[model samples]
Target: MLLIILGLALWIGAHFLKRLAPDLRARMGNSGKAVLGVMIVLGVVLMIIGYRGAEYVELWPKVQALVGINNLLMVFAFYLYAASGMKTAITRKIRHPQLTAIKTWAVAHLLVNGDLASLVLFGGLLAWAVVQVILVNRADRNWVRPAPVPMSREVMAVVGALVVTGIVMGIHNWLGVQPWG
Candidate 1:
C-alpha cells in the first residue's frame, strides 16, 4: 500500500511538475524530460509490484453483468485515447480525451473489481487523471478546438482502437484478470 501510494505520487508529481513548478522544470530543460520519463517508468514498476503483492479484500460481490459494461467502457476508452492524438470529431469536442479515457478505464475497472487492490490502483489513477485534467485546463485557458479531420480518418482511428482493445481483451486472462468471464 505504501509503495503504491508513493508510486502514484511520483507519477502524478512528475507529470504536473511542468505546470505546477514551471521555473524549476524549465531549469532542467531537456534533462528534465529524461528524468520525468525515468520517474514514470519507475513509478509504474513500483505500482505493479506493490499491487501484485497487496492482498485483495473484496468490497462487493463480483457481478458478471458488469463484465459487459466494463468491456464497452474499455472500447470507448481506447477510442478516446486514440482520438486524443488525432484531429477527429472526438478531439474537437473533448479537450482532454486521454485523461477522460483514463478516468473511464479506472471507473470500468472499479465497477467490476470491487477489491482493495483494484480500488487503490484504479481510484488513485482516476484521481490523478481528474487533477491532471484540471491543471491542464487551468494552464491553457484559451482552448482552441481543433478543426475536424476527415471522417475516414476518424473511422480508421476507431478501427485501430478496436484492434488494440481486442488485443488487450485477448490477453486479459494472462494479466491475471479474466475480463470476459
Candidate 2:
C-alpha cells in the first residue's frame, strides 16, 4: 500500500510538474523530459510491484455481471485512445481523447475490480485524468479542433483499436488475469 501510494505520488508529481511549475520544468529543458520519463517508468514499476504484493482487501465482491460491461467499455476506451493517435473524426469532436480514454479505462476496471488496491490505482488515475483535462483546458483556452479525416481513416482507427484490444486481452490472459469474462 505504501509503495502504491508512493508510486502514485511520483506519477502524479511527474505529470503535474510541468503544469504546476512551468518555469522550473522549462529551465531543465530536454533534460527535464528525460527525468520525467524516468520518474514515470519507475513509478509504474513500483505500482505494479506494490499492487501485486498487496494483500487482498475487498471493498465489494467481484461483480460477474459487470464483466461484460467492463469489456465493452474497454473496447470504447481503446477506440478513443487509438482515435487520439490516428486523429480520427472523433478526435475532432474530443479535445482530450487520450485522457478521456484513460478515464474510461479506469472506470471500466473499477466496475470489475472492487478492492482497496484497485480503488487506489484506478480511482487515483481517474482523478488525475479529470484534473489534467481541466488544467489543460484552462491553459489552452483557444484550442482548435483537428480537421476531419476520411472515412477510411476512421475505419483504420477502429481496426487498430480492435487489434490493440485483442493484444491487451492476450497479455492479460498471459498474466493470469481473465479480461474477457
Candidate 3:
C-alpha cells in the first residue's frame, strides 16, 4: 500500500511538474523531460509491484452486471483515445478526448473492481486526470474546436479503435485476465 501510494505520488507529481513547478521544470530544461520520464516509469513499476503485493480488501461485492457495461465503456474509451490523435468529426465535439477517455477507463474499471488496490489505482488516476484537465482548460481558455472531417475517416478511426481494443484484450489475456473467452 505504501509503495502504491508512493508510486501514485511520483506519477502524479511528475505529471504536474509543469503546472505546479514551472520554474523548476524550465530550469531543468530537456533534462526535466528525461527525469519526468524516469519518474513515470518508476512509478508504474512500483504501482505494478505494490498492487500485486497488496492485500485484496473488497470494498463492495462484485457487480456482475457492470462487467458488460465496463466492457462497453472500454470500447468507447479506446475509441475516444484513438480519436484524440486523429482529425475526425468526433474530435470536433470532444476538446480533450484523451482525458475523457482516461476518465471513462477509470470509471469503467472502478465499477467492476471493488478491491482497495483497484480503487487506489483507478481512483487516483481519475483524480489526477480530472485535475489535469481543469488545469489545462484554465490555462488555455480559448478552446479551438477541431474541424470536422469526412465521415469515412471517422469510420476508419472507429475500425482502427476496434483493432486497438482487440489488441488490448489480447494483452489482458496475457496478463491472466482474459477479457474475451
Residue 37, model 3, lDDT: 99
lDDT of each: 0.89, 0.92, 0.88
Among residues 3 or more apart in sequence or in different chains, the pairs in candidate 2 whose N, CA or C atoms overlap within 3 Å are none
Best first by lDDT, ranked:
2, 1, 3
CA RMSD for every model?
1.1, 0.9, 1.5
TM-score of 1: 0.96
User: Candidate 2's residue-wise lDDT over 71-121, tens digit each?
Assistant: 889999999998998899988888999999999999999999999999999
Instruction: Give the TM-score of each candidate.
Output: 0.96, 0.97, 0.93
Residues 79-171, candidate 3, lDDT per residue (tens digit)? 898788777777888888999999999999899889999999989989999999998888788988887777887787789888988898898
TM-score of decoy 2: 0.97
lDDT of 2 at 158: 88
- For residues 1-181, write the lDDT of model 1, one tens digit per residue: 8788888888988998988999999999999999999999989988888888888899998999999999999999999988888767988888899999999999999999888988998999999999998998898888999986889979987998899998998787778778786
Give residue 49's error in model 1 in angstroms.
1.6
Instruction: Evaluate model 3: give its TM-score.
Output: 0.93
